[model samples]
Target: MDKVEVVVAHAERATLRVGDVFLKVDADRTRLDAEVEAMSLAPVPTPRILWRKPTVLALAALAGTTLGRLGGPSTGSPAAWAAAGAAMRKLHDAPLPPRQGRAGRSVVALTAELDAECEALVTNGVLPADLVTRNRRVAEAALRPWTPAFTHGDLQIAHVFLDGDEVTGVIDWSEAGQGDALYDLATFTLGHEEHLDDVLAGYGADIDRDVIQAWWSLRSLLAVRWLAEHGFDPFAPGCEVDVLRSRM
Candidate 1:
């Protein structure tokens, strides 16, 4: 029998990998439902759903390794990065999933949320006050109106899989829904800004650089506390904190 390997564990959920199968256990049924639906609707490659229960989902493993890690450079070639961009464009162009719920926050609501999170960061001293303030101002550019598109919501590099120079699959779709397209681009390139040109080249579209930068700041700021609580050190070298510092 294959041993169960813990992939990740947090208060909200956990994932276990046994052989070629991944079992995702979550308390929130809605998120699981979203994941199932998004995978079905996506135009790009997604993991095969082996089976599903209310509290647990079993998925077949995809080929190849992850595109990159959060705190490290992607060893993938430029073509692989561009392939990921092309895949994202396909996903963005796909039809919206049915019964979309809480697609994303409104501009006013997002700004308010950023403000509250920033205050918490400063009060808790998770990040320096000046860094928090500067990033907060920088994040404002992303608060404007945007045309809704099918989005991965959490399109982190780690979620994308590549086989040599080709994108094989993209996983983790719980947060998928209609949202700003730029948010996906920003999230995918979060800590690895050097690959933006290659990604954009493959995406074959013009993108707002300022909006992408703003999202980089906003996402890092909003995520620090949650990551810390989840036993992830965003302050590690070449990690989220370094992403923020690069802006200064």
Candidate 2:
């Protein structure tokens, strides 16, 4: 029998890889439905779905390695990064899924949430108050409205699979919906700002750098506590903490 390897496990969700089959188990049925539907709607490559039950979805593994991992430099070539960007551009340009929901928060709401989260971080000493405050201020610029586009709400580099310079597949679509396009760009390059140009070149369109930076700060700030609580260390070297510190 093939060994079952845990890819990611958290309170709300878990993913396991057993041989060539990947199993995703989530408590949220809606999210599972969204992932299945999003994969069907995405214009670019996606993992082959084998089957799905109420709480679990099975997918066939894609070829190649993930584009990058958090807390490490991507060994993927610049061309691979560009390919991911181009693929993302294709996704953004695709027609909105029929049942897509608004997946973005208002600037006012986000600002309020940021302030609250920052306060909690400081009060808990989860981060230095100065670091929390600085990133919180930096995140404010992203609160402005954006023209909606179909988005993979979470587009972390690890979700992108590459074979040399080609993007083989993009995974994890539970967060896919109508949202800010820059958010996807921002998420893809999180903690790896040096590769932003390659991605932008492939995107082949003008982008708001300020908004991308703001999202970086916003995302890092919002993720720290949740990550820590989930037994992941956001403050690890070259990870979310470094991303926030780079903004300082």
lDDT values, one for every candidate? 0.90, 0.90
Please list the Cα RMSD from the true structure of every candidate, rounded to 1 decimal place: 1.3, 1.3
Query: For model 1, how does the per-residue alpha-carbon lDDT over 58-157 read when each residue is reduced to its tens digit?
Result: 9999999987788986778889889999999998888876644343668888889899999999999788999999999899999999888899899989
Least well predicted 10-residue stretch by lDDT in candidate 2: 98-107
Q: Compared with the true structure, what per-residue lDDT tens digits does model 2 show for residues 186-205? A: 99999888899999999999
TM-score of each: 0.97, 0.96
For model 1, the superposed segments whose C-alpha errors exceed 4 Å read 99-103
State candidate 1's TM-score.
0.97
RMSD of 2: 1.3
